[model samples]
Target chain A: MTASTQMIEEGTALEVDGLVKRFGDLTAVDGVSLTVRAGECLGLLGPNGAGKSTLIRSMVGRVRQDSGRVTVMGKAAGSTEARMALGWVPQELSIYPRITCRENLGSFGRYYGLKGQTLKDAIAWCLHWAALEEKQDDVAKTLSGGMKRRLNMAAGMLHRPKVVLFDEPTVGVDPQSRNRIFEMIEALRDAGTAIVYTTHYMEEAERLCDRIAIIDHGKIIAEGTNEELVEKTFGRRSQVLARFDGETAAIEAWAGRHGGRVKGETAEFTIEQAGEIAPLLDDATKAGLELEDLTLRRPNLESVFLHLTGRELRD
Target chain B: MIALKRDRGALVLSFVLPLAFFSIFAVIFGRQGGGTPTVKLIVVDQDQSQASAALVKGLQSESSLVVMMKPEAKSKSAPAPADYTAATAEAAVKAGDAPVALIIPAGFGQHPIAFGPDAGGSTLELLNDQSDTIAPQIVVGLLQKAAITSMPSAMADEGMKYADKYVGGFTPAQKAKVDEELDALRKAEADGKTGAGSGDSGNGNSGNGSAGAGIVAVNVRAVVGENKKSPMISFYAAAIGVMFLMFTASGSAGALLDEAESGTLERVLSTRVTMTKLLAGKLVFNTGLAFVQLTAMFLWGWSAFKLDFFSHLPGFAVMGLCTAFAVAAFGMLLASACQTRAQLGALSTLVILIMSSVGGSMFPRFLMPESMQKAGLLTINAWAIDGFTKVFWRDLPVTDLWPQVAVLLGVGVVLFLIARRVARRWEFS
Candidate 1:
């Protein structure tokens, strides 16, 4: 194995130490620190305005932190060597719309000082990786939304950097395209590339992330594997979700009396075992509540996010 | 309409554009500060006689003419510069320091007027810049009136001398003839006269010695813009072309704002490309685009307006490149100063239009008031048009373009540096 490849395989590909970023009086990232190793995907899960984007931006060298340090491949962030080793796919569709997909990749590859055969090979690999071989020469503006998003991702990764930050890359894409993106990311992860993925979707984190960091108000409140987060927040417990057809105030009062959260049309309760759901339903029936629906499921990332922040994942 | 009302940029372009245009047009074409455009006239009184002195004094008395005998003093208490000679006066007109110059030849006051068989008098030479067609006519007409009104003794003495040489060589006889002619003119005027005085009101070369045909002979020579196949073609090309080039440059530079909004700028910064390098690339692209726009304009002028483009290619290229660089830098500054595309649109339009109007694009700076003409020097368009004028109209060699080239390149560098400073916000956070 090549020495550079070996080093990347065994080293910390990305590291952030006490990164503090502030805008006016609002601290967007408050003394946050994390590390991503090779062959691992770290997903940042948060609700809206939870500082997930700010943290990712700081790591990518797009945001200048007021304090602390970020290093890629053991070099300082925003330095020439570090920049060459880092790749950022912003949440916004950042590719040039007037140019074709191949041209966009060529332009970005040139920015990274790639040329000739190397640039051509990088373009080809990115096209194939993004499943955009057929639309390689099509103008980005004319492409479908998912294709454009894929091209945006491909442009940032043309140099094959050791660390890649994908900021909400699957936003606004259809199901099939999201699946395609997931497959592309999985391939990158299997190639031993350290990746930071941020999304509001709970399932995406559950399926792809080796570890998940939950951020709220510029601080990481909980971080672990999906099972670990759910276990940490709600141990040995399953959630009881019941929809009762009754007066809104009466249902809210009954759920409150039973120590359940009435969110929208459903009442949620954290039970240690599945057997506890029968008593809750029986209590609901005795309170003159007509049960419309009920679900017994293990607690998940969404449940953990809710239990920790008292807000929906999409709020 | 509602959208337009809400968008300040569109609102400014809609109402403020017309108002700005009107104000500039009024300041240029209408009366300004209750004063007329003062013509700059350099006077060289070689004869130094009574008639010459009186004529100089009369021209100085004219509020519409700024008559200068020598260049301005360097300091408040410094020794005055030498008075201009005939050669220096002609050079001043050619150098565009003044539109017209009057050089009273030697012995002009000896026989200022000639109306005999030998109407031999030293002609007062009026050297003019052909770029300003009106200044020569105004100078010539004013010269005749000033000579008649300011130097009546010189006119009569010459008339008497002419009569003595032609008729009887007697003062009494000459005086009697002049009185008889005056009585006859009075009678003709009292009878509602028509064509009873003179003819050939232009040039006054008749030597008829009649009223309105002029009393003094003046030689009018165009010291600049004399050999042009067409008048003001190069001036128009440079003027109008530079104005639109600014628009093209600013609009092209607005792409930076686009990339910033779309997040491509952020992504690009994450790569090895720094903000300085990105702005440099954009400057080169914008400069080339402006040069192409200027070339197309001149090529069209060459084909249609008989612009002397082929012979002045070297000067044109130098001036064109410098002007494009300066304007591109200006665009970059505007783009970096503004936060959004709408702000850029409004600000660039207002600034470029104002610059164009004041910089000799809408009208020649020579016709503006002296203060406005001096103000024209502050804009890139003025320097560019001046350089192009020297090349195509004055037929000057490329070496003469150093002043303009220096200003434009310096302006470009300074503006680019400022733009780079202003663009730091996009570099991080």
Candidate 2:
């Protein structure tokens, strides 16, 4: 075990160490490691095909890692005890379409060994949490896209597991459903359930994650809180974006001296303090530069991801 | 098209499976042009007299019957003891030793088989296994022809006796005329000529009176076994019922692929349920469904066609359960082999259709060529149909159906083991 593997603490809900998975010549997930403590939500932020899904699958034991260990509540991953304490909300709609919502819940609940009144209470609570009580008798295929997404999330959490893994749980749902799902997930987090959420949406990660791990090309290049990531990537610098009207050769020269980059008619200057924007504007005015529009923007997770990976979060 | 290229299993199923089934069915029906094959007949002759020899010779002369006589070491002229007793002959027919049995009674030749109000007729017992409807009828026709040929000589001998006793006081001229007419009548009967007016030509009193009393009628006693007289309807009912049950069971079991596609299979596997429990539950449900479907078809056959379904309920029940289990396991195996629902459907349809065609569901195995009949035995459909025939048509007791039941259950066990191994990769991944 390496230092990362030894980082597993007593209250850690999930600990993955030196995980590596490969398909033929292509390594889908490189030697990546992370841990999520109880009551914490770790956002796995990455672009499509960034090995986020592969890493999460390894953690859940859906796919065997070539070399590594995933422990859930101190038990080996894929073990019965590990599976019993784990919950998974897959990216796809996993419910049986021909069956009614209640029937789908009942059948999946039985898989968790829930029975009698415990199963009954879990089902009732899931229905209320998913806001599907009114459409409980409706067939899953007949429900709107958002309702299905909600039900999918509810099904994963029905067993009241110690750890829940969500892989883009709100991929194609309505905004309202997405908000409701976030609320439910937050409630679970408050109730001491560790969550590992993977998504390409930067805003969702920024709003929901306690800590963000930006993965690229099967490797986690950065891992920290959103504020920490922003500061580390940009060093407390804010961007000043100025759009000029014409071929602004003078503005490009002034931007070069000020340690800024210019693209087409736009010039962006990275300033150390917000007050430095006044002196920059004065300098640009004296250089005979015409600014059509100017705006000051703060650095964020999106910037951190773009700076670290040299690509947009959605790319 | 790209997916098809990627999935070689699906590509093979789409093209090769249908073609293979077509080839098999074509070969089966192509060689079925020769009409009505010969039936094997077992002869148990208890009477070694000359008259019984004539009866045996008459049956042997028929082109349609292949007579199988017991080996005897005695001289031709002596009364050779019967090689097989009546009980033994019946046992041979029941055990499928022969399709038909003819038991000649001890006094068949010694006592005249008298026809008319005062004479009692002797019966030649014909035992039929009743598995094939056409074979028994052919055997019956051949036996009747043999009786017709042999009965005339005995009747003419009786006629000669009547002439000496009843016409003793007649004048020489009248007796001479009667003898001439009797000789002509015997010749006409031997020549297979029959008309009511020809015998009435001369000596009206002696001709008609002697003809009526001297004609010894032979009774053909047809002893049909437990399957009843006609077995076609019941035989077909079982065959078609089992075939359709296979289709329904396979279709239902294909839901596993659908579940996999929907990701529900992965979700379920992530829970506390083991892969073994999941597959066992599916097998049980599919088998139960198939059993109910087959039973409904059987009950329908009983109500609509009056098939003797309830008479041998135990045998039928055993066959139904075993067949359902076997078919369910087969369906699961197909599902495990294929990655998608379309592949499963195509492959299973191909297999079931070919099996049913060769195994006597669409056409009777008896009607097919000899090679095809032997090939059909390798399929589950053949064993199931044969078991059902034993219960419904042969009226065989439950104990006799063990071979078929054991074969079907054994197939189920083997298929289940293979399917379980293959399906684990699908479920756990």
Candidate 3:
């Protein structure tokens, strides 16, 4: 916990404040605020049309926000000066396929005002990092999907900016490649680069994020460390997964008495509460129920997000 | 710049294709009447001997003949008139080194006596190469005429000596008969003339026998100036230049549509690059490329077709500029209005091709029916090409081309403004 607090404070690489974008009457992004700090990986979780892409695009200057300030390295996002300090891998594999991988990196690096020896070094470094050194001379279209994904990441990081933006970089990638991407992201974080990652995969967010922001309908509904979010949402109650041989009427009476959310058939209802499994079992015995199996799960971020946003994370 | 350079295939396609077409078309179209072999001649004679001079003068008068002579060129091995043959003259002509060899055979003057009209002799020999089509005919005709004209005087002198020897006293009637016969012979010889002199007899022989009778006219120089090129070559040059300029512009304009589709244009706008700079770069590139295309095509014209392109270069340059402006503007305008690259390509190609066909890229406007020519004038290609012809083909002053130039430039300016407006809308939208 102490380490996470230190990470969060140091984690804030990109601080997006009150971000808003509108197309005519429709609001695509609305008042989304979050932080990606140094040495921390933040997962931006959302469904389709969840303003995830819009938020990322605004941060990268692909889409201009009607109102909001995105600060990268404490400077306004999309400013040449700020863009100079950040790397972005857009959701689309936005690369010129006719050109070679080395050419792609060189072009992207040039956009960051790198040239000469530095540009050359950046290209070589990226190719090595993407594990594409052997395929560097090949055209982008010839590479496999995973190789392309790796190249996309390498292109983003070519200039070695302070913060990197990955807009669903693992979409359509193989699981192995996805794992490799996570590893690379972890490696980048270990090197003190803040990463803002957006995806629809909950398990990925859960496994990879130091902190997570669950956005829906163009706004962030909940954001915190995974444990903090889960504990905060379900702290008063914990989910008790128990299988009991009992009368339906007796279980109903027990649920009514205990005042927790009871789900499933009368023989078994998982009660969400914390700190009193014994009391529950004793009460059940007094009611003449044979409790066969029981287990407890304190809520995780997935549950917290689902609870706060009222939608399944995978949905 | 690095990105642009990295896309070498695109750069090559953009620049190389037009140049290749220009080279090939230039060689084909520039050829003058399919490259038939011919020669031109200039002759100088110093010998005053009637016979010696007549031989030299005879070859000099030949049409399409290349004749050059000097005191130093007269070799000791000159062939006799009896020995001279068509094969000898043809060999000289084919060799193309020396113009024509004059072999004034020994005793050439004496042969006429045997073949005089009164003598009834059938053997009189003056040799030339009849195989050298134009030159031989002119030379032989002139030589024969000179003999006939001088022979009469010679005969009159001989008659005096003979009559003095035979008749001691002459009757007036005998002298009258002789005079009448001489006049008749003179009349007969004068009636048998040929060559270009036969058409304009007034210019050929109107109280100016010496002037008309000369084999070659002195102080003659042919000037092929501006507008003096063959109608076919002139029209083709102008039409091809205008057509290719349009193609170049349309291609660049189509690039704008590509940029828009790829969202590259939006990306560019997001940067510090402004629309004006972008448009300017495109136009400059297009215009410069068009100029290069024009120059290559004309160099072909000049080399193959005897096209006097240099004389009309100023006019061609001006016409090219106007045509380039019109095409560039029209292309950008088309791009601005079209939402996609496919639409832009199809629409611009259809419009430009139709204009080129009607306006005389495929054929000359003059060859078209009068009504079609009138219709062609409405197309910008026609106006632009016609302006070029007025300078290069009609030999008209460039000042006379202003109306067309003004119209073309006006259209270009209007189109450019419209295109700018459309591009701005697309950029923001």
Model 3, residue A215: C-alpha shift (Å): 1.4
lDDT of 1 by residue, A1-315 (tens): 764456455778888889899999999888888889988999998888889888887777778889999878877888999899888898999999999999999999999999999999999999999999999999999999999989989998889988899998999999999999999999999998999999889889888999999889898899889889988988898898999899888789888987888988799988887777788888888889999998888888889999999998888
Q: Rank candidates, TM-score, best first.
A: 1, 2, 3
State the TM-score of candidate 3 restricted to chain B: 0.47
Give me the runs in candidate 1 sitting further than 4 Å from their true place: A1-10, B32-36, B76-78, B115-118, B161-213
Per-residue lDDT tens digits of candidate 3, residues B1-429?
786576554454456545544643453344323322122332332223343444344334433233544322455686423322434443433333232343343344333233223442222222222222333333333444444344453345355546755679457887777778766654543443222221111111111212112222111111222124353676777788788778777877787777666544544443334577678667767767776787788889889998888877788878778877777787778878887765566566666766787687876654344456677887888888768766675566678779878989899888888888877764442
Query: Which residue pairs in candidate 2 collide?
Result: none
Q: Which candidate do you rate higher for lDDT, 1 or 3?
A: 1
TM-score of 3: 0.56
Q: After superposition, how far is residue B427 of candidate 2 from its true place, in Å?
A: 3.2
Worst 10 residues of 3 chain B by lDDT: B200-209
Question: What DockQ was computed for model 2?
Answer: 0.58
Could you report the DockQ of all the candidates, in the order they appear?
0.83, 0.58, 0.08
> Compared with the true structure, what per-residue lDDT tens digits does model 1 show for residues B1-429?
899988898889888888988987787767544433567889999898766777776667665668899988989899988999888888878778898898888898787765532477667778888888777766676666666655655666676666677776776775787777655653443343412112112332222222224666777778897777788888999999999999999999999999989988888888999999999999999999999999999999999988878989999999999999999999999999988999899999999999999999989998987677888999999999999998888878899899999999999999999999999989878
Candidate 3 segments exceeding 4 Å error: A1-13, A38-40, A62-64, A73-76, A109-115, A157-159, A236-298, B1-230, B244-329, B354-429
Candidates sorted by lDDT, descending order? Answer: 1, 2, 3
lDDT digits (tens) for residues B11-111 of candidate 2: 77778877887787777665433434556778888887655666676667665566878634468886765566778777767766666687777887765
